[model samples]
Target: MLIRQLEYLVALGREQHFGRAAAVCYVSQPALSAAIRKLENELDVTIVLRGRRFEGFTDEGRRVVGWAHRILAERDALLADLDRMRNGLRATVRIGAIPTAVPATPLMSSLFSTRYPLARVRIESLSSREISRRLAEFELDAGVTYLDNDTPPGTRSVELYRERYRLLVPADDELARESVVEWAAAAALPHCALMSTMRNRRVLDANMAAAGATLVPVVETDTVGALYAHIATRRLASIVAHTWLHAFGVPEGMCVRPLAEVRPRPAVGLIVSDREPTSIVVDALVDALSGADLSEALERSLPPVIPG
Candidate 1:
């Protein structure tokens, strides 16, 4: 049977109505019905349980529908593979990243663009757990996330950088005068923090607990820029990724100090599936990371801005 017939079958199973399924398939009702009938004839089985209207699939038809899903998915993947091979990594490469790692996306995109200037690079800000789920389902080409978290099976993670927390404070703030701030001391200040839903927020929370500090943030937000805003006004302080200061300078009037004596830093890195015959785009993206030290690279690229 043709793939169209299989599509018709899948649509029928999903919609559970002949006219509706035909509409979804963008074909006449009779044409869809004829295709599936031909499918049933070739297989020598009654595929659908029919009445005046579409009933449901029989046991055998259900099995065929399951196979159809896998076959269609594979078919699309094969076409994508062939296109990439012919186009030389020109297809859109979708990369998901945790919010804290977003600053690194522009660097990766710039690297990928050098070899394939025409290629489209899409970067999405997502949670670590959400990135893992999307990676497992093949919805995302790669992910930039904490490599130490529970990784999905069949996915490989390559550490790109060790992410450390930094305390951001106003320039005139007494704490900002210090070159290094202890975790307990930083956590004790009246500060704005990332919302509890963020993975980095959890990491900071654990670090505070381990440092025997009580963290009662005066304001909580989901975005780093908001925290920076509060701290910029000199009304509050914040803890944020050290790397973030590279792409984005510490807000005007604010300074950053490295957090000290905290728990071990987590490694944030690139994650892709280990499934054989990886997509060329994925391969190229990984290759772009070769010999790149995220921390050092960022430091060299953006010299210490004087909080401008």
Candidate 2:
């Protein structure tokens, strides 16, 4: 089948609506439908289950879509390789990062851009699971996520740093003057935490559990900015990653204290698909990371947890 036909099929699989998929492919509805039909005839398999509206793909269609993803990814890789040979790394590197890892993304992106000025970098904050799914589906070139757990198979990673925690509290809070706060004490305060769905929240929960404490946050949210707002208003305290301080610094009305109980720091890193004939853009990013000293860079840029 033609590559354009496969493009239409993949877009259809993603959008799940005939009109929307056609729009994505920049084609008329009839044109997209006819191309898929032609593909089906050539393959001798019904790829779509049709009805009054856009029905889901057939069982065989799902298999075809899987192959389509692989083919399109390889095709893009081939084009990228040729472009690099001629133009020297002119492609966008799409990256998905967990929220906790978002602050560190600039370090990686800046390094890549400096090395390959013609290339572009796009970053999205996504859940670790979403990162893994998109990487597997060939939607992302790389990811920044926890490498110690839930890393997808068939991928390799390089650790950037170990993530440590701190208790962020309003400047007027009882523990605000302290250089460190014990987990048990922090858990007892009015606290807002990441939603349980986030892997960072799970890591926080496990760490608290190990410290003979449990977090029952007064409020739960998915974004760090929300947590920061709550603490700034003196509505709650929070356990946040040390990396966050590097991005946001301490909010004007707040301060962060290192957790008194030192636990195992989770390793956060860059992950890329391990399949052969890797994308050139991905290779450039990997090469950039090879010379990066993000761990030390982050530490030096961040003000002390308890400002002197």
Candidate 3:
């Protein structure tokens, strides 16, 4: 029997009405009925209960419906497996990363390419929350996000590096001369910027509050790029994770300093679903990220910024 007929049977079982099932399947009721009849004839079994209206499947049909689901799932897996072998390492490895982790993408990409030599990687900017959701849905093969705090359930994690917060300000700013800025002192500065959705911001906020001050960011943005851009224009001073500077070139006449008060720096890492299988390309990317020395790689890939 045709797979379409099997699909029609499964839809009929779910919808429990010919009209509704046909509507879901985007076909006329008669067409669905005819397909089911053909299927029954080929199998030489009474698959459906006949009545004035559509009814539930027969016992034989019910068993067959279960088999159909399994069969279809296997069919899809087969196709994916065949495609992978045929294409070698050329398949797209869809990845999601937090704003702070954006800078680390190219180094990871370069290392992955050196290993696979043929794989193509697509990296998307995503928040930690969205990254977990996409991974659960199997839309993303892997994601780069906070390793400990924001990670969701049932995912394999790979620790990459610890991201320490640092201050980015104009070179001529009053606070620039200090070896390090206290969280309390930085909050009192004019025009401080924050990334509203990031866990990094939450950490900064908590640190500032602990230091007997609360942040009142003159600029709040979703992306670190925007925060950096504003700092470049001399509009704001921002507390940024060290990883971001690895990705983007800093503006002229800017300075950076480690935030001494915010101790026990947070860790950043990769997360992949435990339920979903990692494609070859994804494995290569993971190997590259886990195997390389991120601090040294960042130094080589990125222009020198004021060291934190």
For lDDT, candidate 2 versus 3, the one ahead is 2
Q: Supply candidate 2's per-residue lDDT for 23.
A: 95
lDDT of 1 by residue, 21-136 (tens): 99999999999999999999999989999999998989998888877765665665677668767865557888998888888888788878986776789999988788876665
Q: How far is candidate 1 from the true structure (C-alpha RMSD, Å)?
A: 5.3
Error of 2 at 52 (Å): 1.8
* lDDT string, candidate 2, 1-308, tens digits: 89999999999988999999999889999999999999999999999999998889899999999899999999998999999999889889999999888988888888888999999999999988889888988889999999875788999998888887878787788888777788888888888999999888998888889889999999998998788787677557888887888888877777778887565678899999999877877888889997577889888877676552
Best by TM-score: 2
Off by over 4 Å in 1: 1-73, 233-235, 261-263, 301-308
Q: Comparing candidate 1 with candidate 2, which one achieves the higher lDDT?
A: 2
Cα distance off (Å), candidate 3, residue 272 = 0.7
Model 3 Cα lDDT, one tens digit per residue, 144-243: 8887755798888887777766677777887887887888888877655656566778878778878999888887877777787788886577777667
Q: Between prediction 2 and prediction 3, which has the larger TM-score?
A: 2
| RMSD of candidate 2 to true structure, Å | 1.6
Q: Give the TM-score of candidate 1.
A: 0.75
lDDT for 128 (candidate 1): 79
